[model samples]
Target chain A: MKKSIAIDMDGVIADVDQHFLNLYHSEYGVLFTKDDIAGKTEETLFPEAGAARKFAFTPGFFLTAPVMEGAVEAVKKLMETYEVYIVSAAMEFPLSLTEKHEWLRLNFPFISWRNIVFCGDKSIINTDYMIDDHLKNLDNFKGKTLMFHSFHNVNYNHHQRVNNWDEVIKLLVEEA
Target chain B: MKKSIAIDMDGVIADVDQHFLNLYHSEYGVLFTKDDIAGKTEETLFPEAGAARKFAFTPGFFLTAPVMEGAVEAVKKLMETYEVYIVSAAMEFPLSLTEKHEWLRLNFPFISWRNIVFCGDKSIINTDYMIDDHLKNLDNFKGKTLMFHSFHNVNYNHHQRVNNWDEVIKLLVEEA
Candidate 1:
């Protein structure tokens, strides 16, 4: 039987940090280079206390977020061996659900809609492996945790960490 | 942490059976009494081989489905003790995602969006209890399975069955 892998969307497959960083620069004239963004939490990186809520509620935020480096190809490659399911904690923003759905369809045309999970809490996910940026999601997952590197989770060292799609492929795909 | 209960939307809470019956009569002059529906599968109940695909693809199908008897109250009551999650295998119909989301919001207003899960396969769901109509969903569930009675699953008697929302409450709520 093919082992199943649950992948987080926002900060892992989608370049949410870059999206927020670019938006932060354009919205408030606050510019931070990619080098400056490392090890910073969303709260510390953005000026507004509830910037995530505001940005997520924005109509085009999810639809237009840049895809992470090599995410599209890496996911398709992983499907050869694993039942790769894209799990995104997207329920909080009602508008983002359809937007994320559309984004996945447009960018990851190879991904079947069946493999996409739009949920609120990732704790309910059951898979052989999970790759996520948040501890709240990875900590509770009943699987091998691969902490996808993100500004918020850079300091966390509990789970196996993958800095990019290449690292993920090396750890999961090639190793297997 | 409260024990989680995954509730199927189509046949369990939302009355897809009633919706299809009404639509079938209006669209093709086909009629079936609720009694006539018992012990019949989707293939047997509808004339067309692809009736479910056709009906699900039809615009506003999930949104217009009637709520099963006492489902709203029963789910709300279950939430007091269980983390009631509305789990719908809605990925096959992309058009139905937002529609189902809106349907739940409009009908079960008390249900938080956080408690909703939109996915393709029910196998990945991790919860303490699962209430669904299809064996495909309930059979592999690690949790205690409560087969919500529907015409399609009335004959397959592997799991404990609940004929209506009242029976669901009796088996899950009062028994607890």
Candidate 2:
């Protein structure tokens, strides 16, 4: 059987931290740096939880967000050997749906529409491997977990970590 | 808050039973009809469960299935009022993912990509209403469940049944 890999979008493939920082500056009139957010939730960066959540609800937030460096090439290379699926916890932010779809089409056109999964919980995903930034998603995953590096997840050390897509390719290639 | 509705694809919107029957004829040299599957699982229709499962694994199976009559117009009208989401138990049939996505794009272009959800279990879905053909999906749903008519669910009468999209419109419009 071909080994299937489920990859998270935000913070893993897409650069959500940069988008959040930009949103934070515009919405609150304050400059927030990645160093300040290291090992902290977005809610901690904002005055209230709603303010951070509001940014996620903004239209085009997911679409306008920049892709992670080397994500496109790495994903394409990974697709050659593994069944790659973009599994996102998108149900919570309903506004991001169409934008996320268009973003994927523009960035990773090779990925089939069938490989995109939009859902609330990641626990239902049954695959050989999962690449994600959040511990909440990785903790319950039944497959071998690869923790994609992110500022918020800097403190987590439970799973094997990959700082960039190059490292991701190295790890999976070695496994194969 | 706007009422949210989750609709099932296979039986409620897209006609998969007919497609499976056609596949059964071609694969096994046996003719099968909707009547043969009334209140019975796909396993009963085929010589073995593996044969029926093979049909789902077939490429282009989801894309080629015909849409339910009046579904396009009814869903378009419903989208004007309700926050509609297309939810499918698609994880079990990983091969159908991209085909199902393209099928939706061709049939329901108005339905945004964000509103599309493909997962295994329906119990995790949080919505105000659900229109599904399977009792397994509807029975555990937290909100009002409208059972879309399907041969496999003909014997199930626990939830409110709608024979067609016309009936679905009447029930939902009345509630609104």
Query: What is residue A103's positional error in candidate 1, in angstroms?
Result: 1.4
DockQ of each: 0.81, 0.11
Candidate 2 CAPRI-style tier: incorrect
What's the DockQ of model 1?
A: 0.81
What does candidate 2's lDDT look like per residue over B109-172, in tens digits?
8877667888666665667899999888898888999998887778878999999999998888
Stretches off by above 4 angstroms in model 2 are: A27-29, A47-49, B1-8, B12-116, B119-176
Error of 2 at B133 (Å): 8.6
For the candidates in turn, chain A alone yields TM-scores of 0.94, 0.92
Name the docking class for model 1. Answer: high
Best by TM-score: 1
Off by over 4 Å in 1: A28-30, A48-52, B48-52
Worst 10 residues of 1 chain A by lDDT: A44-53
